[model samples]
Target: MKTIHKKNTTFLNLAAAALMVAALVLGCKPNVSNGGEVQPPVTDGCTITMSAGANGSITASPVIPAGGKVAKGAEITFTATANPGYRVDTWMVTPTKALTADGQQGDAIAKVKVTANTTVNVTFKPIVYTPVAYADLHNHLTTAQPETNGIYYIEITGLTAPDVTGNSIRDSASPLGQILNSNRQKKVALKFGAIAGVTDMSSCFNGCTSLVQVSDIPNSVTDMYSCFKGCTKLEHVPNIPNSVTDMHSCFYGCTKLEHVPNIPDGVTDMYSCFEDCTSLTSVTLKCEYLDGKFHYAFYDCSRLSTGSIKVPADSLDDYKDNADKMKAEAEWFAKDE
Candidate 1:
């Protein structure tokens, strides 16, 4: 081999020595920084994004750090809330994160400790159910007759949740006769709702001496001949249905009745709707069709004076005597004040 040049050898030696010195300085560096232990190299953390389905929201505890970024070992609780008419269906976690609560894989609440990037999707579903509605119908009297005395009760079908405006309902034409003729019982409990099919109520509660209540007059009735002829203890008559055409002797002897319902404009015959109502002081006969007849409609109402009827008496000039009988025994009609 050719002999090496002196300058080249010297330069090589210098370079080798310089590299060794640099390595020593770097390896001997202090393990401290600003009086604190040195920290590991910085690395990116995991990311978590939540997706809530329609009409629902996800609430988290220890908030999944801002922007869905969290430490490697951080734990987060995700709760799903659904609005009215909805229920929680599932909490779908991506990559199958660690769940603290035991339940089906995709349903129920989840407490997750993230190991990597995660995504939780909340899926809500509409609750499914079916509802049923119906009614009961019974025939003949069911309640046992009173052990003693005059106590009677009757049930009316379609009374529960009835259509009040309905007028075709069917019921007993002579409910009182059926009850009294059997036992001659006195006390009566007339439970009823809207009258939808009843067409007659003649003598329905006639001669109920001990009947304290004359249940409301039916709206489906066309007749009321002596319906409450002798309900002496009845304190009130709620209303007279607009469908009634005849109200002869309807409240003929309700002596204790102080109030009478307004006579519907449809009534064509009021022979004695409120006859002998001695306690009544005022009356209204607003029927516009009443031209000349209502014979003794309020006859013997001793407390109601002549002219006490509230009809357009001038329009009934020919039957003033009948109109007079419509008022209390001597009471006069009430003129417009």
Candidate 2:
């Protein structure tokens, strides 16, 4: 009985040892080989790059592969950078209707199948031209008649001296005076004395047939001759200046001139001053030099039938002597009456 018990114990120990060896062998076995080969990580394809220039330039790289398959509902991106002074104008992508970086128009992208590799580029630049300026009346006002036929009352305020040579305020042959002679020109309002050294009204107002009225006369004027001659429509005249030394035919042939203002104290000569003013009724000669020899001065003023003329009381004798000649010249209006 003792021997049998010992043998059973031995068998139990052997079974336990076999179970331990089996467990160790299974635990020590390798699951993989030791060749040291590395596996590559999966990546979705897209790239970006840049170029530069003197003014500016743009560059892009490794475009979307043509028809290259991408998983459905997958997102893809492309990006670029620009140099100094240049601004990105636009961007675009093509083929498969997959996804886009920024909202841009062109081909849409969904699931991409890149049959051929593609590339794209964007461009940039700066600004260019500008403008200039000019003088105001460089070609506006002139002596020539208005191109369109219409009466224009021109006030030459700032223009006292003509820009061209031989054209001064006192000269009749001036460019401004020539403009006044244009028969097509209806009326003009001349404002003098804006410039210096002008002192006469000779041919300035001569041959201006359309002149109806003249307002301010430059006090600087010293001579007054044919200034008011051909101004047949002039009904009223402002007072002559005291600086005037000559009054030769000043108001001659101004047939419509009905009224005359008082002459300034400095006037000396009155040669044919009121010769053809047939509408003048009363004469006021306040001068001391009204001699009977000053004949034909008020010659053809035929409208003086009943109106009294006031000459220097001392010069009444001189006027009474020349009354016959005055009556002879005034016979035209008398016959009309």
Candidate 3:
């Protein structure tokens, strides 16, 4: 037939060229050129960081966005760093317009606004603490006897004696006989081992007009009437501690004693002693018993006629007949010496 029909058309054109080379070796092989340019795939948002256990650490960025939608006011900002010695005293932001910066030198920065998912709080404080000192004089008859007003300064360093029955200090029952009739203490210092077991210091610094000072006097004190009655700034009268006997009214109104000490011979009774001192200038007596007859004992001593009056020349006729008013005050202080 025509060569078998042209061999079936050359076997159908070699099966159509072997199906187009097997579809070009399985779809066009090598076309590789990966020189970059492909990106696009990374989405992560919401982030915040801050920490401090001993002090230091803070950060905030990406607090939610990238399509996660949290933007109701978006404005977050935060930064803080300070470790070593730790110092960043203040920086705050906690719900309410948030905005702060102060401390850590400069740049502690802070700003807030993501309205919904919010939480901010920060605080720090420390500076100094240490100091103390005390001296509280007899602590107001022991622990401020129920504190009434206030006015205290204590420095009575070791009182010599006299605590009679003030309970040694406890609401004072006799605290030195009620501080010898206190007027709210203006100044007092009976310091240096305050004579103890006082016998009878009559009136004991009577109306102490803020006694200036009356140091050590305790030879086992015996008796001395009205001892310094209305002491209006007594000038001097310290030595008399020979275990005295009796010298009544001893310096009644020491208007400002000038001098009067040598009256030691176991005094019997010079009653009304120096009644109204009025600034007596002199007096020396070795008492052998004036027999208490100087009635008003130099009544208004008016400066004792201006000084000098020693007794004991053998009791000068029993002190001029039982001291006729102290022999007219020792002949008016021997006619003014």
- lDDT for every model? 0.59, 0.50, 0.52
Worst 10 residues of 2 by lDDT: 127-136
TM-score of every model versus the real structure: 0.44, 0.46, 0.23
Tens digits of per-residue lDDT for model 2, 118-236: 33334443311111111212233343343121223333444453321122245343344455555423643333324455565565566567565555566777877667776776654
Candidate 3 RMSD to the correct structure: 35.6
Of the two candidates 2 and 3, the one with more favorable lDDT, higher being better, is: 3
Off by over 4 Å in 2: 1-151, 159-175, 193-195, 290-293, 324-337
lDDT of 1 by residue, 163-245 (tens): 22221123222433444434343444344555557676667667665555434556667766677777786654557788877
Error of 2 at 120 (Å): 91
- Candidate 3 residue-wise lDDT, 235-297, digit = tens: 545567767876676666767665666778787766777777775767777766445444666
Q: Please name the candidate that would achieve the greatest lDDT relative to the true structure.
A: 1
lDDT of 1 at 272: 70
